[model samples]
Target: MRICIVAQTFAPQEEGGAEIVARMCARELARHHEVFVLSLGMSGDRLAPTGEATGEDGTRVVRVNWHNSYLPGHKKPLVGRIEKARWHLKASVGAVSAKEIREIFAREQVDLVYAHNSARMQPALFEASRQLNIPLCVHLHDYALLCPKSSMFSAGGNCDTPCLKCRVLTSRLKSDGEGMTAIAVSEALKQTYLRAGVLTKADWHVLRNENLREDKLHRPFVGRDSARSDIFTFGYLGALSEEKGIEDLIRAFVDMPNRRSAKLIIAGRGREDYVRHLQSIADGAPVTFMGFTPPEEVYGVADAVILPSRWREPQSLILIEAAAYGVPIIATNLGGTPEIVEDMKTGWCYDPSVAGSLAGVMEKALKIGHGNWWAERDKLFPGIRGFKGTAEASRYYERLNALLVEAQRPDHLHLQAL
Candidate 1:
C-alpha cells in the first residue's frame, strides 16, 4: 500500500520531536509499505515547491510549500496559542489551494492519508483531506485539538485542575455569544471534526502503546544499571520554552540541596532570551548548555531527567527515553507524563503547582539505593514501547490498512491485517 504521511514540517527541514516522530514512522512504514511524506518547507532551505528527499538511506521524503506563520527568519514560531493559531491560519489558510492538494493526491495515487498534528489541529488541512476524498488518519501528537496552547495549560502556567475556561473554548463562546448556539457549534465541531468524524471516521485513529517489538535493545536496556554518584546530573530534554516548565525547574534546582556539584543540562531549542535567562539563573552552578545533542547522546549523558512541564505535555519522549535508559525521571504529574513515569517506580513526580516539589523529588532520587534503581528500571518494560524502533509504529500502519479495507469492503468483514 502506498502511504502519504502529512505533517507540519519534516526532517533536514526542521528538527523537533514531531519531526522526529514523522521521520521514524516514515522509515519504519517504508520497510513494509511504500511511504512518502508531504511536509511544509522550512525557512531558508531552497528547493522546488514539492520534491523528494530521503529519510533514512532508503526512505523517501517529499517537501511541500506550505506557509510558515513565523516570519522568514524569526525564532519562537510556536510561542503561544495566538502564535500557533496564526501559524495554522498561515499554513493552509487562504494560501495553498485545496485543488492543488487534490491534484497531488490524484497524481500520487495514495492509498492512505496519515497526517500528524498538522491536519488534526489545523482546519485548512482538514478541509483539504475532505476535498481530496482521501481516507485520513490524524495521530494525536499533543492536545492541539483540545487546547490552543496544545498544553491544555491556561494562564499561571500549570496543568493540575481539569480546564474549563480554556482560551479556545472561551474565545468561541465570546464569538458565538451565549446560549445554545455557541455550545451547539462547539459540540458539532468536536463531534464532526475531532472525535468521530473528520479525524477518525476516514480510517483509523492510531494511538501508540508504549513499546515496539523490532528493537531488541528493548530488554536489557543499556546505561540503566549505572550507579548514582556525587556528581549528580539533572537534565531537561525537549523544548526549553516557558510552557515547558523550564523556569520552574530552574527555580526548584536553585532550592535543591548542594547545587554546587549537581549538573543541570538543558537540551533543545526555544526562545533565546528565555534560555539565556535560565543559564543566568544557574549562576555557574554546574549547569552545562548542551544545546540539542543527538537523541542517543542525550540519553547517554543523562544521570536523571527532569520533565517539569508547566503545561499538559500530551506525551513526553524525554520521560520515555529516560525510562528506557534507566535514568530516573522527576516530572510534573500532568497529562501523559504520569502514564509514562510511575511515581517512585520508574521515577518520581513533583507537585507541578508548588515551588519546591521538583527540588524535593531530586533530593529523594539522590537517596534511592542502587539495587532499587535496577528494580525501578525493570518496571518500565511494559511502557518501553515508546522508545522501541518502528515495530510499534508498524502497528499504526496495520491499523490504517484494516480501517481502509473495511471502508472499501464494508460487507466483506474478513478482518484485514496489514
Candidate 2:
C-alpha cells in the first residue's frame, strides 16, 4: 500500500515530538510500503510555497504553507480566547486548501492518508480524504480538535469543562471529525474525545509512542548504584512552558529542605520571556538551564528524570524515555502517567494540585537514591524487548496492518488497543 502522511510539520524541518513520530513512522512503514509526506513549510502566516523536497530521513515530503492568521512555530502561540477562537474559526474553512490536498492525493495515487497534527490543515483534510474515497487515519497527539489551545489548558489552570468559547469553536470541528479512523497515543485521550461526543462512528485504538531518543542504546543505565546517595541531580528536559509545570518544578525544588544536597538541570528552550521567567524564579538555586540540549546528554548525568507536567500529557515521551533508559521516573499522577508509573514500585508519583505534593516527592527521591527504586531494570520494564525499541515499533505496524484488514468488513469495525 502507498501511504501519504499529512501533518503540520515534518522532520529535518521540525523535530518536535509529533514530527519525530511522523518521520520514524514514514521510515518504518516504507520498509513494507511506499510512503510520502504532506507537510507545512517554515514560512510566516502567508499561504505560499508549493513544492516537494526530501526530508532529512530521506522520505519524500511535499511542503506547503498554511492558510491561517499565523503559522505555529517558535513564536509565542495565539493569546486571548477570543483571538484564539477567531484564528481556529477562520483556519478551519479553506475550499482552496481542500482542492490542493485532493490534487496531491490523486497525483500520488495514495492508498491511505494518515494525519498527525493538522493545526491549520483541517476540515479541508477531512473533505479531501472523503473525496478520494481512501481510508483516513487521524493520530490524536493533543486536544487540538477539542479545544483551540490544543492543550485544553489556559489562564494558568486546566479546563475540566468546555467554556462557551470552546463549545462555539469546536462545534464544527467535532462535526467534521465524526466518522474518521483514529489512533490515540493513550486511552485517556480516546476517552476525552469520546466524552466530548466526537469521533462516534470512527474506529479508535491506542498505541503508545515509542522512545525517540537517538542514544537509546548508547546511554548507560543512570542508577546502577541504588544505595549510594551523594549529591543528587534532577532533570527536566522538555519545553519551558507554563502549562508544562516548569515554574512549579522550580518552586518545589527551591522550597524543599533536601534541595541543599541536590541540583536541578533544565534543558530545552521555549519563548524567551518564559525561559527568562523560569530562570528568574530558579535564581540562586543549584539550577542550570542548558538551552536546547539533546535528550541523551541530559539523561547521561542525571540520576532521575522529572516530568512535573501540570497539564495532562496524553503520553509523555519523557516518561517513556526514563523507563527505557533504566532511570527512575518522578512525575505527576495524571493522564497516561500512572499507566506506566506505579507509586512506590516503579518510581515516585506526586499530586500536582495539592500544595507541597511535588516537594514531598522531591524529598522522597532524594532520601532514597535513584538506583535504589529501580534495582532490577528488567523486572520493572519487562515489556521492553531491547534497547533498539523493537517492542513498540513492531506492535505499531502489526496493529495497523491488522486494523486495515479489519476495516474492510461491512458491519463490524475493530482494532486491538496496545
Candidate 3:
C-alpha cells in the first residue's frame, strides 16, 4: 500500500498531537508499506536547503507550503451571527488551492490519501480525492467535522446548547474569512461530501483516539515520589485557548484549599490575550505556564494530570499519555473522555460546567496520595495487551485496509444509494 499522509502541520514545523500521530503512523506504515507524507509548511517557510530527509524509522517526508493568506490579519471577534457567518467564508477559500493540489496529486500517484484536518487546511484535498479517484481516509482529530467551533462548545463558553451552525454558514457569510472559516468549511464540506455521495465511495473515515499505549504502565516518575511531598503538582497540557478551560483551571486552583503547596503547570501555547487573562486570574497561586513541553516531560513531573477542557475533547491524548505513565487523571467528563477514563478507576472526572467541580475533584485526588495510587492503577487502566501501541496501530491499519476492500466491492454501490 502506498499511503500519502496529509496534514496542515507536520514534524519540524509544529509538535501538535495530530502531527505527532501522523509522523508515527507514517513511519510505522513505511516499515511494511511505502508511506510518503504530504504536509504543508508554514506560509513563509521555504524548503530547507537539504530538502527531504528519511526519518529515523525509515519514513519519507515531503513538506509543501499551504498556509492561507487569509490566516494573517483576519483574527477578530465573532460577536453576532453575521460576523461569524462572514468569517467562515474567506477561511474556506484560502486554506488550500485546488489547482496546486491537483498538480501534486498527479505527480504523486498516491494510492491512498490519509487527511488530518483537511476540512480547514486542505479543502482542495477533498476535491482532489474525488478528481483522482483516490481512496480518502479522513481522520477526525476533534469535532471539527461536525461543529464550526470544533469543540462543539457553544458560544459564550457554554456546552449545553445543541449544535446549530455549520462551518458552511460561516464560510458562506464570509464573516471573518480567516483560518476559522477554513476550519468550518472542512466540517461543512465533510458533511456535505459524505451526504451528497461525493466521497461516499472513498476508503474510510479514520477517527484517531488517544495514544492508548499501555506498555509504559510501570514507568513511574523518575524521582522519588515521597521526596516531592512538599510540592503538589497539577498538569494541564493542550492549547491554551479560551475554550480549553484554562480560565477555569486557574480559578479552581485559586479556590483549592491546598493552594499553599499545590502548583499548576500549564503547557501549550495559543491566544496570548487569553494567557495574559489567565495569568491575571492566577493572582497569587502557583501557576507555571511552560508553554508546550514535550509529551514525555509534561507527564514526567506531574503528580496528577488535569484536563480542564470546557469544550468536548473528541479524545484527549493527554489523558492517554498520563494513563500510560500511570499518572492519575482529573479531566472534564465530556466528549470521548468517558471512553478513556472510567470514573474513579484510571482517574477522576469532573463537570466543566460546574464552578467548583474541578476544585473539589483536585482536592480529593490530592488526598489519595501518589504512593497509594498504584493499588488502584490496574482497575483504572485498560487491558495491557489491548492498550499497547503496536496492538492499537495494527487495529487502525486493519480498519483502514478493510475500508479499502469495501470500497472496491460491487455491493457498495447499492449501499451508497440507500
Find the candidate with the highest lDDT and give its number.
2
User: Residue 332 CA error for candidate 2 (Å)?
Assistant: 1.0
Off by over 4 Å in 1: 42-56, 67-94, 120-124, 146-149, 158-206, 209-223, 228-230, 343-345, 369-418
TM-score for all predictions? 0.73, 0.87, 0.73
lDDT on C-alpha atoms for all candidate structures:
0.56, 0.71, 0.58
Q: Summarize candidate 3's per-residue lDDT along 1-418 as a digit string, tens digits.
A: 6767776555555455666666766765666666777765443453321125555666666655444432211133335866555556545555556676677767877777766654564456666766777655555565544455555566656544324455453242112111111111123333433543333433334334443333533455422123233476787888887677788888899998888767888888877787788889997878888986766566677777888777666566666566556566788887666555663255677887676988998887667655554444455443321343333544655544455434434343312210
lDDT: worst 10-residue window of model 2:
382-391
Worst 10 residues of 1 by lDDT: 176-185
Q: Order of candidates by lDDT, top first? A: 2, 3, 1
Clashes of each: 4, 1, 17
Decoy 1 TM-score against native = 0.73
RMSD for all candidates, in order, please: 6.9, 3.6, 6.9
Error of 3 at 380 (Å): 6.6
The Cα error of candidate 3 at residue 399, in Å, is 5.3
